[model samples]
Target: CPALGDVFCIAQCYRAEKSRTRRHLAEYTHVDAECPFISYDDLLDRIEDLIVDVVDRVLKHREAHLLDEVNPTFKQPKKPFKRMNYSDGVEWLKAHGIKNEETGKFYEFGEDIPELPGRKLSDKSSKLVILMLPPIISPTPGINTSTLMIREVIFDRCEKKERILPIR
Candidate 1:
């Protein structure tokens, strides 16, 4: 078998969005890794592990006091972050009586969760949410391989969270 390896990058990025929100920035730093060979389950596991590890490191580091001051309400997210499939998330929104912003109707499966609604859902869900199976499944661009991609988002409750929503 040919040797295959993971690829990662941290780069300055810009968005072409017209609507501005706390989460939507004209420019930001994007860090991502492409592991074309990993299984779906493995990707989820790795993401959780990475989040936990990063938090642990941050909390233990000498500059931990800075984080405490910046987000005084912050706390270490529990292990095995709550997992919600797209369908379940839609059901949760519907159960919570959250309506779609654009359509002004009850949220249905395959609908994009608007920011406010999504935040409400996340706030009620837990500290760290592992939302999986977003509406897109396309071959990843800028990465070496052409493997179909899936989205696995981890939300932090204390701050505005970024949604790595689109995969082109």
Candidate 2:
């Protein structure tokens, strides 16, 4: 471990941009963690372990019954979330016939996918793990392992709700 070790902070973060959706908030609590001297695989494992531990704790808590009321099908998502690179994800989208409503062409690399809820499989609960980001859009050039994107959408009472812990 480096001198700093792994540091975590729950700080209040604000987004200046205006957004009407519930997913995009103006002010929200941010949990930030920085792990130094660790391999990319180690970081991913740490995240998966944390998620599993948290879910186990939550299910064991006194108010866990409330979760059942909200969603009886809620279960611990399987381990080692599915990993999908950017280009591959785009291909999946194209194959599924999901594309930009305005543009009839498939999304090219380096172009941010505006929204993709159909990425979820009907029977499986899997989150996307983008391993290699495109260089054209990556803020950190030449650094391939600095980012981990796990994006998913959940429908609550027929409402589209996104579930992604902002971790980078």
Candidate 3:
């Protein structure tokens, strides 16, 4: 295995196709990071820390004036973001009466949560949302991998919650 560390990049990007999630943009600055050899929890912790640090710093030195003028009520998210598995998220959505636009039915496992439903879920839940797939035990020998093939749903207070939908 190769040495592992986190790498980050910021760039102006655009996709040919449209995306429903607010996190996506036709033209936006993308903040990306990659880290190998870390557990999902560790990665989450790192991401949380980075977001808090960046937001705080930006508000303090960079965009405070603009933010104050435009949206003074905006507040930085608190640390230690919450975690929930996919099944529970689906239950929460169902209990809350969130439904798919096409089917007009409450979301179920294996159904893709489109942008509207995802936004509805976020509007109802806590501020930050993060969905994490637990480590996978490989069926084949000599490798352990957790591809995003599993159908699970998890909702939380952060932007990562969009992934709660299955990859249909």
Which candidate has the highest lDDT of all? Answer: 1
Cα lDDT over the full model 2: 0.53
Candidate 2: list runs displaced more than 4 Å: 101-105, 118-168
Candidate 2 C-alpha error for residue 50, in Å = 1.7
lDDT of 1 by residue, 27-115 (tens): 99876877767876687778778777878998999999998677787767766767677667788888888898788899876566766
Can you give the TM-score per candidate against the true fold? Answer: 0.70, 0.65, 0.66
lDDT for residue 22 in candidate 3, whole number 0-100: 66
Ranking by TM-score: 1, 3, 2
lDDT of 3: 0.58
lDDT for 49 in candidate 2 is 76
> How badly does each model clash, as a count of residue pairs?
0, 0, 8
For candidate 2, the per-residue lDDT at 16 reads 87
TM-score of 3: 0.66
Worst 10 residues of 1 by lDDT: 159-168
Q: RMSD of model 2, in Å?
A: 9.2
Per-residue CA lDDT of model 2 for 45-151, tens digit only, reads 66677777888999899999998897786757546765554555567667776666558777665455553433342222345343332223334333223344432
